[model samples]
Target: MALDGLDHMELEESKGGSGLRQYYLSKIEELQLTVNEKSQNLRRLQAQRNELNAKVRLLREELQLLQEQGSYVGEVVRAMDKKKVLVKVTPNCRVALRNDSYTLHKILPNKVDPLVSLMMVEKVPDSTYEMIGGLDKQIKEIKEVIELPVKHPELFEALGIAQPKVEWST
Candidate 1:
């Protein structure tokens, strides 16, 4: 009876050992799956970080382009040779131009300034000064000043004086 009881105890211990092994294996597998899921999430986040870095680099390049400073326009007065030109950029100064800097186009009337472009905008085929009105007094003044000097020269001669000259400028 004592030997039988010892054998029965051995059998119970063996079954308990198998249960503990199964529990350890299930726990280990759960931990391994958790690690795999965290690794996948980390990889996804790293890829998103790389994509955002690329967008930032593109925006930086665009900002640099928008911050550029200077280019000015000037006229070429004369072509000196193939490599240079005389450019008149200021009232009293003349600067040389590069070979590829200037181009020549047909003259277009400058209509940006109304005072400068009054009657000089373009040449009409049939234009007349008759369109101007309300200048009778001004026209008579001009005619008297001009024709009096030519027609009545003796008046000035008799008075021993020269006719007064007038000049008009726009």
Candidate 2:
């Protein structure tokens, strides 16, 4: 009876050992699967991070290019604006215009006397005057009108011709 009891106890011990081994192996397999899944997730996140970084770099380059273009355009506009001419009749009375703006400058007695006295008269180019087609009659009329102002200042005042306004570029 004692020997039989001892044999049964040994059998029970072997069964328990087998069960524990199976449980431990199954737990280890589950842990390995979890570890592999986490590693895959980490790799995917790293790839996404790299793509985002590349996009940010591209955007920064584009922004820098735009800023440079903006500054260049600003410089061009400033140069264009600086090409204007400022005409001052008196110290307080001033008018500004671009060189290409007006067809002619109507000379008054006061203005002509100063220019003639200073010998600063500039002859108008025939090509410039001829560019205004159908203005022959107008030019003749303007010459006739200006003759009185040049010859007689009192007559011009009586005729009441105002100071001409300055023109700007198109």
Candidate 3:
């Protein structure tokens, strides 16, 4: 009877030991899975950070070139999320239209306004322009309708066209 009880105790001990070992093995697997997931997450974030850094570097180079050109490129009226900027563009700026007044434009990477992108992105050094069919006619019309009014206001006045009252207050 004593030998039998001792045998039973050994069996129970073996069972408990095996159960503990299995539990530890499962725990180790869980921890390894968590580590792998964290590593993947880190890699994804690093990739995004690298992309954003590249974009920032490109933007810096563009700003430097604009500064060298001595053109009124525009001012960052507001910066939002490092991705978008509210730019106050002067009338002479390419992004600005006919009016001799400053205008606010929101410039973004992917969601840039069509007109703004046409005026801004076309100035890229690597871009090429295919001449449109009616571009010369459009230019002539623009010169007569917009440039003439601003450059020679007397011509509009002589044609009895009422001009907006411009305040030259400095």
Best by TM-score: 1
Q: Write down the TM-score of every candidate.
A: 0.40, 0.34, 0.35
Best by lDDT: 1
lDDT tens readout by residue for model 1, 60-138: 9999977754333445567799855666654223233333544432233332567766868476456333665888787
Indicate the TM-score of model 3: 0.35
User: Distance from true position, residue 133, model 2, in Å?
Assistant: 46
Give the better candidate number (2 or 3) by TM-score.
3
Total backbone collisions, model 3: 0
lDDT for each of the candidates? 0.65, 0.57, 0.64
Candidate 3 Cα misplacement greater than 4 A, ranges: 1-16, 69-170
Model 3 steric clash pairs: none
Q: How many residue pairs clash in each candidate?
A: 0, 0, 0
Residue 58, model 1: Cα distance from true site in angstroms: 0.5
lDDT of 2 by residue, 1-170 (tens): 45574576566568776755666688999999999999999999999999999999999999997765211000111122444433443422223222444312332232235657678647745565568898899887876665545655676577787533333233
Comparing 1 with 2 on TM-score, the higher-scoring candidate is 1
